[model samples]
Target: MAETYPVLQEAEPFYFEGNDIGILVIHGFTGSTQSMRDLGEAYAKEGYTVCGPRLKGHGTHYYEMEQTTYADWIASVEEGYQWLKERCQTIFVTGLSMGGTLTLYMAENHPDIQAIIPINAAIDIPDMAALQNERETRFLDAIGSDIKKPYVRELAYDKTPVKSVKEIVMLMEKVRNGLHKIQCPALIFVSTEDHVVPPGNSQMIFDNISSRQKRLVQLDNSYHVATLDNDKELIIEETLRFIKRS
Candidate 1:
């Protein structure tokens, strides 16, 4: 990273209710806690300790992430793990996109997680990876550094580093390699027609996870970012049920 990590202030105040229920809602790639704000508030209103930490190298200068690796991203989630330990007796973690990959990583590594919910979670990139030709496209741009940019919205910022995309792909590989290790209850949410990460990504997790109580939900009217779409409320309700059961 180009600059030292800033001590980001918490997005929402901690609601200290007596309820021991808790949730850690993680956002998608290049997204901040803002994307999960509504869902976080829904859980918080129910007196759950909802912690949504901005992943490393996100919600800031994208160029600063040129050197950042997926390891840094996982470290950010680890910090959230420590923060939530004392807040609730049982903790549920849920994430979107790359966030979902990290959630599986956590659930696989940390057996103590009460339950896990991955919304439009991406794992096993080669199955249905993002971008048509991301590696070649990114490499050409990097070599020239003067090539006309492609993509939209994100390209409006500093173009995604080729290395960063590779790192995310590596993250997917790591998560896929450890999929069967996740024995905890899992609620996998997927959009039937996700433009970013396809539904196969979710199925990969559902197929590999050993959780007997696991489930998969196909969301319509939503693309890649289901956490912010109309089906979010259903996700919230179903997740609450899964957490209670587990």
Candidate 2:
């Protein structure tokens, strides 16, 4: 027997029409476009076309994610990129957690990407050995909603599929190996108190990437889900500045 979960309305994908500069906003693993909506809207308000794509198998149910692979997630973002490429002259990519990882992956592959902003991206999973040993467990406790803000929770799955975790691990390895291939200007954000991804992961990305114009900004007042946390405004302001300058 398999588990069943309902689709969340708030997790649907979003697109906003604006200027010729397009922004592709991606959400974290186990999370939907809801997590990145505020950031995308901020860009849209500033006259940048924004598209927030709901990754395949996400925003629906964890059981559905079990049926997906990292390739499927990549295809989802690639489609969004193509959509923006057709409408805009310049394109920027940004994402959170696994979304951030995929952002880096895109920059590595797409030399023409104007710039990149990866927030709290995951490079290494600390509990990989333990997770691999859990052969009997098909699911684990949710890793979503690690926000510090009160009365706010991330719209994400309540459970994490073990197989999906493995898929992300594979994606992380591929991205990690290709870090030096990324030459686009980058603005990397790391939450000092992130409970999901180790803060050191950001440092590793900063050190490994070949971007000459890369910066690491530390969020002192947020958790893993900084996009929806107390420092959300800072992330938006700095990102807007980065986009303008880049």
lDDT of each: 0.73, 0.94
Writing each residue's lDDT as its tens digit, candidate 2 over 139-225 gives 989999999999999999999999999889889999999999999999999999989999999999999999999999999999999
Give each prediction's root-mean-square deviation over alpha carbons: 5.9, 1.7
Tens-digit lDDT string for candidate 1 (46-125): 77887887777776656666667999999988888777887678888999888899999999999999889998887765
Best by TM-score: 2
What TM-score would each prediction reach against the true structure? 0.83, 0.97
* Clash statistics: count for each candidate: 0, 0
For candidate 1, the C-alpha RMSD (Å) to the true structure equals 5.9
Q: What is residue 151's positional error in candidate 2, in angstroms? A: 0.6
